[model samples]
Target: MNIAEVSKKYEISADTLRYYERIGLIPEVNRNKSGIRDYTEEDCRWVEFIKCMRSAGLPIEILIEYVTLFQQGNETIEARKDLLIEQRKQLIEKMENVKKTIERLDYKIERYEQSVVTKENELKRTDD
Candidate 1:
């Protein structure tokens, strides 16, 4: 597939895909004779993996490191596993923080609703 096709299929912009390639976030893409990117299945898989990792809030620097490790062959398997484990820990912490914030927001919203109801009831009593 071409750059545009890969961009549409992945729901990512072509510029972003180019940037990812330039930044080494994804592996190098093969270009056609005309210098247009021709994404092979392997390239597309890397794009999908990068997109998923990015959407999960993984930092670009970490991804670059992971890609570097990946390029170094299978000997870095343990190191890659360690990196993923660390990233997972960070994501879990962020999730816990988000859960707490959601609970706080819910409580505040409930309080506001109760206040509104109490004020409405008071106005009704006064009009009676």
Candidate 2:
């Protein structure tokens, strides 16, 4: 597919895709005879993987190192696994913090709602 199609399909900007390619965050994308990008299934898979990792809050520097290790062939398998495991641990911690934040927000919102209801009820009693 063309860059535009890939962009729409992946919900990413074409410029961002080019930037990923330029920065080696993704492997090189093949271009047609006209020098336009033609995304293969493998390339698309890389794009999807990068996007997913990015959405999960993985740092670009870490991803770049991961991709570099991935390109080094089979010898780096163990190292890559270790890297992923470490990143997963970080992501889990981040998720826990986010959950705590959500709970705090919920508590605050509930308090505000209760206060509003109490004031409304008090106003109604005064009007009665």
Candidate 3:
């Protein structure tokens, strides 16, 4: 596969892929005889993984670190695990905060509805 094919398969732009490579977020891609990018199955798989992690709100800096550790062979496995765990913890905390905000919004909406009803009742009494 080429860059175009990889881009279409991952729903990512070619420019973004190049940017990832340039930023060291991903390994440098191989080139063909004409110097065009020659993406392999492994490359596409890594792109998909990176996209998924990014969409899940993982920071690019952390991803770059992870990639660096990955390039250093298997000795960095523990560090990689620690990084993922930390991100997961942060994501959970953010989710909890969102839930609290949603609850507050729901309470405010209920109070507004009650106020509207009370005003309607007062208007009806005044008309009597």
Candidate 4:
């Protein structure tokens, strides 16, 4: 597949893919005779994994480290696992904080609505 096809399959922009490559977040892709990117199944799989990690809010610096470790082969397996575990813990904490924020916002919105209704009722009574 080409870069465009990979981007379409992953729902990421071509610039993002290029940036990932440039930033060492992904391995260098092969090029065809025309110097265009030639993506293989392995590349596609890597892109999908990267996308999943990114969607889960993994930091780009960590991702670049992960990719570097991956390129270093099996000796870094334990280190890679540790990175993922740490990131997972952080993501979980972030999700909890977001939930708390959402709950607070919901409460505030409900209180505001109630206040509006009460004011409208008072106005109606005064007008009558």
Candidate 5:
């Protein structure tokens, strides 16, 4: 597919796709004779993987390292796995923190709800 088609399909802008290619985040795309990018299935897969990793808060530097290792053939398998594992560990820590924050917010909201109910009850007593 062309750059425009790939951009629309992946929900990414063409400029971002170009930047990814330039930054080595994704492999270079094959260009047609007219100098238009033609994205193959493999290219699309790379784009999908990069998008998922980015959404999960992975940094560009880490991703570039991963991609570099990936391009170095089978010898870097362990290194790639180690990188992913470390990132996963960090992501888990972040998730735990977010969970704690959610719990605290829930508790605060419940307290406010209880206060409102108490105030309503006191108002009723005064009315009677």
Candidate 6:
């Protein structure tokens, strides 16, 4: 598919896709004779992987390093695994922080709800 099709399919902007390619976050896509990008299945898979990793809050530097290691062939397998493990650890930490924030918000919401109910009850007594 072309860049536009790939961008729409992946819900990513074409400029971002080009930026990824330019930044070595993903492999360069093959261009057609007219100089338009023609995204093959492998290229699309790389785009998907990059998108997923980015969505998970993985840093672009780490992803670029991972892609560099990936392109170096089989010898970097352990290095790649180690890099991903570190990223996963960081992501887990972030997830924990987000969960705590959600819990705090839930507590505050419940408190406000209870306060509203108490005020309503007091108003009913005053009305009677």
TM-score pick, better of 2 and 4: 2
Off by over 4 Å in 4: none
Ten consecutive residues with minimal summed lDDT in candidate 5? 1-10
lDDT of 3: 0.93
lDDT of 4: 0.94
Candidate 4, pairs of clashing residues? none
lDDT of 4 by residue, 53-84 (tens): 99988889999999999999999999999998
- Mind giving the per-residue lDDT tens digits that candidate 3 earns over 1-128? 99989989889999999999999988999999999999888888789989999998888999999999999999999999999899999999989999999999999999999999999999999999
Tell me which residue pairs clash in candidate 5. none
Number of the top-ranking candidate, with TM-score as the measure:
6
Give the C-alpha miss distance for residue 120 in model 3, angstroms: 4.9
Q: In candidate 2, what are the lDDT values of residues 1-128, reduced to their tens digit? A: 99999999999999999999999999999899999999999999999999999999999999999999999999999999999999999999999999999999999999999999999999999999
Residues 1-128 of candidate 5 have per-residue lDDT tens digits of 99999999999999999999999999999999999999999999999999999999999999999999999999999999999999999999999999999999999999999999999999999999
The TM-scores of all predictions, comma-separated, are 0.97, 0.97, 0.84, 0.92, 0.94, 0.98
- Which residue segments of model 1 deviate by more than 4 Å? none
lDDT against the true structure, each candidate? 0.98, 0.97, 0.93, 0.94, 0.98, 0.97
Instruction: Report clash pairs, candidate 3.
Output: none
Ten contiguous residues with the weakest lDDT in model 6: 83-92
| TM-score of model number 2 | 0.97
Candidate number with the higher lDDT (2 or 4)? 2
Question: Whole-model lDDT, candidate 1?
Answer: 0.98
List the pairs of residues colliding in candidate 1.
Answer: none
Q: CA RMSD for every model?
A: 0.8, 0.8, 2.0, 1.3, 1.1, 0.6
Tens digits of lDDT, candidate 1, 57-105: 9999999999999999999999999999999999999999999999999
Each candidate: how many clashes? 0, 0, 0, 0, 0, 0
